[model samples]
Target: MGSLFLTACGNLNSSSTSSTTTTTQSSSSGYQTTGQSSDSEYQSVIQNGSYLTSKARGVGITQNSENMLNLKAFESGLTTLSKTEFSPKDYIFREGQLLSKSTVQKWLSRKSSSNPTGLNPKDNGETDADKRNPIYVQQIEEQDYMKEENGKLVLAGITIGIGMNRKDYYQKEEYGATYTTTISKAKMIAEGKKAAAEVLKRVRKLKGASDIPIMICMFEQAPNDSLVGGTFYAYNVSKSSTLGTWKSTNLQSSVLPTTSESTAINDNDESSFTSFKNKIQNFFPNLAGVTATTKYKNKSLQELHVKITTQFYSETEIRSFTQYVAQAAKTYLPSGIPIDITIKGSDGDIQAFIARESDSSSYYTHVFDD
Candidate 1:
């Protein structure tokens, strides 16, 4: 929450900014100006800035401060925390570890969208309130896992920060590029993993770090579009050029707190998601969009969640709409796969309804989101 910017996009040995003030530009949508978070009223503390001043907070010092490590080309993206130790010895304290601001927002401007609100506001979900203020203070500690290196323990992993803002519709740039919202999901995933592979690009400049494994937390959010538009993502980034492991949490169950799933799916798989989305878009008219994923247990598919966003006029209309979606989706998916449908009106609360293979046993529920 403190520092949201990616490691200053280059060699870790790059020139350093002595001041606490760090400038970073977020991807702006339908804005009066470009996607510059550091410009306008938006400002953020660099993640490394907090790391550089960790000594002031009594956080552990990195093995080497002056030496910048270089990263080799590798596969990257987000994943759950797997090979990390939470002990204090594994943390790397750096300068500016005491940056004041925990989150940075550009609320002075509005991005036009088809949403009923007509304006898209980006929120960093670090706090529970909607307060819109910034301060220059933060106390942060960076931690990594340790591995044996030539008979010695060394810090060997890093968490690469990536965020996906939820909106009426998600827009992203092309691979290897920033600020272009005209790209496909496949391209976005590929590009994201590519970026993740370079987590060491800047931190390696720190003498003590080397061949660090990367973890990604892709926080994708949208404005009440569906259960997915208001949730968090957890992924396990791999260092061996393999796909990252992943998962997510949805808060929309607040609207229907009695819901639960039988099996969990990999929320990060793109191909499965795109296929289900295409099916809904083709079957339903006025489809705002969809977010679908499959969950696996012990390497076998067990559960499916299909979250849909569309237009509806009233309670009866929404119920009928959900009936058709849940039914069709239940029929469309293969046999025995427990499917749960999370339906959201263009700007309404998310209602969860479980659909089974029987076709006669579907009911909407107040699914509890944990």
Candidate 2:
């Protein structure tokens, strides 16, 4: 990730040669009159810095070196074999006459050596993968189709280059003001709608299922603000049957002051996490019954190293806990077989442990198995 630093520029003053002059007169009331200046020097300096930062974040050269190399190889490979007399005029490599198969192979080999990971070695092999040779084969096909059907290559090399560069620019400034103020605001309105449509499509897959509703949250920072703390938007996702669409609901808003202390910052994070968890639980009652435990004790003394054993139970009572424990363990057990939930016969003997997962899908999978 690239870092954004606040830049300062020297303040510029008006030249004495300018016809504009300022005369100040102070009265007993301490009132003074001043001439109107072309611009405030300090204000101008700040504005200039802001403009430069925005532009730099907008068009900064931050190419994905790997992707560019791959693109170059694709273009070069097309240029090499495109020289044959029998080759199609609309083909990607029409700059020269076609070369022999061996010559083409040598060219490809050289290019591949330069970027071993860019082009799959198997692409040139005599297998199903070989059929997909020619690095930019898709581009070539698209170009040919465009010329044959539309009468021209609607998208040129320059256009492709610009698109690639724009992607690089976005990646570099993903957390910068250029993205939030200039790009994301517009993109969120447009792409967020598109994303909502796609979400609706997926929700349709679960039409009548009694599963819990899905929620989405978004956070955006203010312009001229660094992403230090508490600057984001949150939303909840829900399907609207009456409107036949999906919608997001705002949850909360918070802002961290520039002089906020470290303890305050930590408290804010914990509060946000807890609030989010509570909101989910409120919306999904089933989740409330699902208690998560983080420590467990092993019944067998031989496994003293694993002294702690954990288990999960649906019922609130300690006795009924084992039944829920068995259910949780069943998910990971082999098919056509069952495992004993009771580590020991004593009441509340079953201990439950919880583990965090990287994604929402398996958020609770590790607790029972591991």
Candidate 3:
């Protein structure tokens, strides 16, 4: 009797589809061409086309999609500046500064919610919903102050603002609404310092990895216009360091920034399957097609499973070698398969199993555990 085995073959490239627009770029330096559009509305220093069309004039623009959008903007902006006979370095500085301030204004406006009175009946009675009191809040919206630190160009500092409670309003039936103004300058300053410290730590690490610049943007707002508040931070990993190792704890939070990495896989599953079948055909020239079978059984606690055994041959020594047989079988095995060979008498047996549980659009192959 020969060893029994099960195997499965799948097509890998069946899921791949063609795209209409494609841009080729050198993958080594990270300056890959990411396509361009001729539409004037989408035309800008950014090659993506969407950013130029979406961005409003005179408004501060922060890099949105990590290095992809930012690198595109930086490179394109440099090209635009050079063509116009302007200094690229000066433009970066000037634009960055202006954008920082605009971002601060945007942060402040966001703190002003539609319902500031806290008159809504369903308001949960908590510190956050204390409309009677206003808390002093300060924050930096954006900063891009670049300076040389330890032989590396680093961006330090940040854009921030503070809001202090101007008054406390209370209900007085006869006199209508009246309140007293009370502001906490100490609290405002403390929060600002804390934000600065955190931002500084991030800046230091970013500067250390100058090869992979991290662009940082922060936004803060009053929680329900009450004395409570929160902050938001966004950062992008530069294209220059895309292949390097980077860690970002900020991305774990729901409100913070995130990043992505992409890769391509070989897509020629049909040909691969055909090659596999041809190899198997040569191994057992007279053997019929293989079939898959599955068996399942349940046992009770009292019953013990018994083993059955059978023997066919005593012992004999005989051998024959064929390079073609070995080559054909090896070529058909998947890249990750582990092969173990054994011989008895004059016959050879290959024992292995291939289990596939992938969908039509994807290919997944798993070898059975011995």
Candidate 4:
């Protein structure tokens, strides 16, 4: 991974002396800093300059049947929640390293006579549709936090994300039409909590994970037809095998230029996005389309990501258009919030990237050379 930072914009800092330098701060856990990878990788956690990724990366993609939006949001949202307890300054971030792909696959399966370790409801031969067991747990994700002790990195904490299905689709016979089982929010939460408890019990048995604090988050996945992904609704951290009181999160995702009346969209934010879209498109008439996927917390915008498609092919045109986009973003979009914009050609290759960090007025721009 060539400098793991998000490629929305290539590294814009030209005066950097060393590429290996990482953020240094006093650790509350009293562990001295060692080394970390470059901070650009969006998926990997970086703290105290140490960058270790999951032994099993992208496993969630194959395991979970949800759309890519849901998969990405599920993991990233869990990391945001994990930070309240596992501070980046204190703990080194690692992806899902503890739970192997096979382990998670087993946990996602339905409980049966042979598969005794399955976490889902037991398979029963019932003819009635009402009596059938719905597959509550769809996918599971694990993230590990480590700290240096005795000149060695040890497991400090763990966070597990349990993705629950809102609609379970199945086929009764071979090459048959699929049937949908809709799970109510109340029923989903109850099953999610039960799965959390059982997951905690098994995770505690792993080596070196006996006493470390573990955070478990429950995610409600969107329906199949939804363009936006799901959100983590509740989470709880446990010091041992026993879980504690659950806390709820208000994190949610919405597509820009609202399409649904059920989803409450902020008028100001929507209008700002509309303005930004109009400005960029007006600058270049050859543009194909502009869209955004936004994430909010407690009804406040937290992150805005835009994707622009264009028919222009010239590198000079791409760079010039990116500059206009950056200016339009600053003038019309919401200030003091993280914003990322990517310009792509009709072929789907990224042409340029522009990003604005939270609370920063400047925008970083990069146009990829062919």
Q: Which candidate should be chosen as best, given lDDT against the real structure?
A: 4
Best by TM-score: 4
Of 1 and 4, the candidate ahead on TM-score is 4
Q: For residues 1-370, what per-residue lDDT tens digits would candidate 2 score against the true structure? A: 0111222233333432111122232311111111123221111112212332221121212222223332333332222222221123332111111122232233223136554422112334422222323222011110110111122111111001001110111222345432211333544334434433343343334323113232332322222232221111223334342113332322222222213522322343334334433432333223432211111112111100001123324333333433343343333322221112223212344344322222222212122332
lDDT of each: 0.36, 0.24, 0.27, 0.77
**Please, what are the lDDT tens digits per residue for candidate 3 over residues 108-178?**
23233553321112223333324433433222322232332332223332222122222323343556654
Work out the TM-score per prediction: 0.28, 0.19, 0.22, 0.83
Q: Backbone clashes in each candidate structure, one number apiece?
A: 45, 18, 12, 7
Q: Which ten residues in a row have the lowest lDDT in candidate 1?
A: 68-77
What is the C-alpha local distance difference test score of candidate 3? 0.27
Q: Compared to the true structure, candidate 2 yields what TM-score?
A: 0.19
The sequence of per-residue lDDT tens digits that candidate 4 reaches over residues 1-370 is 1012211222324523212222232322222222333342222343344544566666778755647777877887887888888876566666766687777877889888887889888877652456778888988999887665443456788899999988887777778877887888999999999999999998898877898899999999877767778899999999967998899888778887677564546889988988888887866657558888888888899999998998775788888898988998989999999999999988898999999989689999998987
> Which wins on TM-score, candidate 1 or candidate 3?
1
lDDT comparing candidate 2 with the true structure: 0.24
* Candidate 4, superposed: residue stretches over 4 Å from native: 1-58, 126-131, 260-264
Question: How should the candidates be ordered by lDDT, best one leading?
Answer: 4, 1, 3, 2
**All candidates: CA RMSD (Å):** 20.4, 29.7, 26.1, 7.2
Model 3, residue 79: C-alpha shift (Å): 22
Candidate 1 local lDDT, 1-370, one digit each (tens) = 1222333322333223112222434431110111122211111222322322222233211211111110000011111222232222333212222111221111111223332221123333322122321111111123343332332233455554343322122223344322212333454344334433433243344444434454554333222223322122345555544435654422111111112531223333334445445666654456556655444434444555666777765676566666566556544554455667777767766754555632335544443232
Candidate 1 has a TM-score of: 0.28
